[model samples]
Target: MAGLTAAAPVGQPQMLTVVLEGLRSHKGQILVCVTRSADHFPDCTKDPDKRHFAVPVKNGPIPLGTVAPGDYAIAIVHDENGNGKLDTFMGIPREGVGFSRNPVLRFGAPSFGSASFSVAGAPVEQAIRLKYFL
Candidate 1:
């Protein structure tokens, strides 16, 4: 009888692919903010403990790969005007934006916990619906 080798440990690192959809327009950019450190909401200011990727959008999902397994939040801004930043007017975003899990977005961006989710030993998929206001 042949004996099988032991399998790898269950806690191996994995990637979490996030898909941003329903973009109002494809003329802008897409920024993905991911981290295991949750010291602050939208904690993009400090150097991310893991990975961060910003992709110019022409349309459709932008894949961010090889992300470690842990808590993470995905924030995306559809800068329709190509301003290189989220344009806001009177405390409201002038461009389309999105968050992971599609949490109930209020007058402004949602808190880190509201948009956070866990990735375990295997890859995960998520789709965020873009929010827009004229």
Candidate 2:
């Protein structure tokens, strides 16, 4: 038998790939935030342990890197203004917003449970569709 490494190296976290969709235009930057705490679900600002990434806006897959095995929720913002933050008007998001599981966006951001997913020994993928409101 051709024997090789059976699994990932010790201390190596599981990989996560985020497939992005529904970007209004190719401008500004994309912000990806991952959190394990429900309290910091969509906002993620209060969670010091949250994983955040900023990439140029484009139509493609976003590699969010490795994470420990656990339940997690992701929030992504299409910052059209490149302000490094999601803009809003009267609590309404002026830029594009998205969640891990592509949950329905009502009057406000969805709860953590609505977009939660699990990462185990294997790789994980989450597809999110950005939503926009003027």
Best by TM-score: 2
Q: Which stretches of candidate 1 lie over 4 Å from their true place?
A: 1-9, 58-60
Model 2 lDDT tens row, 83-117: 99999999998999999888888888889998999
lDDT string, candidate 1, 1-134, tens digits? 47955433457766567777787666757766776655644536575474555688755546677665578887777777766677888878888778888999877778878888888766667898888876
Cα distance off (Å), candidate 1, residue 107: 2.5
Cα displacement (Å) at residue 21, model 2: 0.9
The clash numbers for all candidates, in the given order, read: 0, 0
TM-score of each: 0.81, 0.88
- What TM-score does structure 2 among the candidates reach? 0.88
Q: Which candidate leads the pack in lDDT?
A: 2
For candidate 2, the lDDT comes to 0.87
Off by over 4 Å in 2: 1-12
